[model samples]
Target: MKKTKTRLAAIAAVALSAVLACGVLAGCASDKGEQKASEQPEQTAAASLEGKSLNIYCGAGMTKPFQEIADAFKAQTGCEMNITFANAAQIQTQINTTQEGDFFIAGSADELKPVSDYVATSTDLVKHIPVLVVPADNPKGIQTVSDLVKCDTLLLGDPESTPIGKIAVKAMTDAGVMEQVKQSGSITTSTTAPQIAEALAKGEGDAAIVWKENAGKDGLTILENSGMEGYVKTVPSAELTCAADADAVKAFSEFLQSETAKNIWTKFGYELV
Candidate 1:
């Protein structure tokens, strides 16, 4: 009986040893695959929908060109992204009270700082704003600021709360005719900056104070004529508040004024500051 028990014990030990050997080999194979993966060159992660989401508060008109660029960022960066567009005043107001977004593109740098009211982190990124435009035909015979005001055409800009509207109102006031003109009922207000030109082109209004970039297109007369260019200033920032995704915001912000964006900007009649 003792001899028989020893033989059985030897068989059990060999089986256990064989199982341990197979487990060790399997672990080594997995480790090799992990090491190989780590050794490979890292891939650039362009902006992606499945990655991190970046919120942008900026001019709605920028949506098209911005998306075109963001599409490429996705192909490369793998970061998620989203944008919330609004007029200058609306954005500033929201930034002051509401939770801020990852980035802020102000029409003027002067307008961007309010983001700090809620969020402590912010950075100015780019600058741009409206330049007056008229019809290609120069209907009502508009030429310069003075001529623009004299005509029976509509003067365009956001309403009073908007920075550009305030600037435009102030400019017209400085030129000595803000109230007189408003009193005369000669002007009409639009929501977004782009609407200035759209209103003119669509014949909803006559002349408009549009962004320079929004001018230069077909069927529009650029009334951003020399010397009367004192209507506004441009400013923007990539950082604002406690942005949840700072990296992606910084990346896209850097591209806002990039040559590529500038080209599209100029195409729209906006001049670089």
Candidate 2:
């Protein structure tokens, strides 16, 4: 009976020990699983991009393209993003005045560079070209750059303060057509590229002069550019102010330079400079 009691006690002790060991193992496994799950998303984001703040100048027609990049970055980084679009020129003025947002994208390099210069990342974000836009029906039978200068033809463009207008005027002048339009009393003015297209759609003008990227679109035809002699360029840039995540901005900026971005620019009838 004593031996039996001793044997029974030994068996009980072994069972309790086994149970305790299982509990400890399970606890460790649970902790490891939680830790692994927590690290997975972070690792994925690091490999791709993080969500971040991306403010673009109002005139940035490439919003759709950029938006795609922002979305990707967000998924990769698990961060948040707030995007605000406004006139590139006005946006620049705002950035210069108040120093707002994480990045600034403009219709022209002038606007992008100014803000970028403040951040020392100017050249990394620029695409230059003469802005070209026209009516949807190819009104004035615009086949060449010279046709845009028809004496009786009306041309709508952004105000001189806007990059689209600035480049349009430069290209037309380089093509020896802008002065002719002025001589013919055909130049009209709007505040933005979309406005110029709107005017043309309304039959307010014989043709429209806007950013080259605005050309060949539904509202307009792409007549011509100033080229080497008369071509103007639109440059775009990015900023680094309060960047939500460095990778997000970097990936997005690179997206602007990607083939997809180039395709968008070309489809819009813009000359890639």
Predicted model with the maximum lDDT:
1
Per-residue alpha-carbon lDDT of model 2 for 13-85, expressed as tens digits?
Answer: 9999999999999999999999999999768756553323455444555555455655655554554656666
lDDT of each: 0.64, 0.61
Model 1 scores worst on lDDT over the 10 consecutive residues at 41-50
lDDT of 1 at 134: 69
Query: What shift in Å separates residue 116 of candidate 2 from its native position after superposition?
Result: 5.3
Model 1, stretches more than 4 Å misplaced? 1-50, 119-129, 224-227, 250-273
Reference-based TM-score, model 2: 0.64
Q: Which runs of model 2 end up more than 4 angstroms from their true locations?
A: 1-58, 123-139, 151-153, 224-234, 241-273
Task: State the local distance difference test value for candidate 1.
Answer: 0.64
The TM-score values for the models, in the order shown, are 0.72, 0.64
Residue 80, model 1, lDDT:
62
lDDT of 1 by residue, 1-273 (tens): 999999999999999999999999999999998887876544433323346777767666565655665665555566666767778677777766667577776666666555546444444433455566666776677665555456575756665545656666666666677777777787888776666767778766667765565555568776545234655565555476558765666666665657776675555445566
For candidate 2, the per-residue lDDT at 100 reads 59
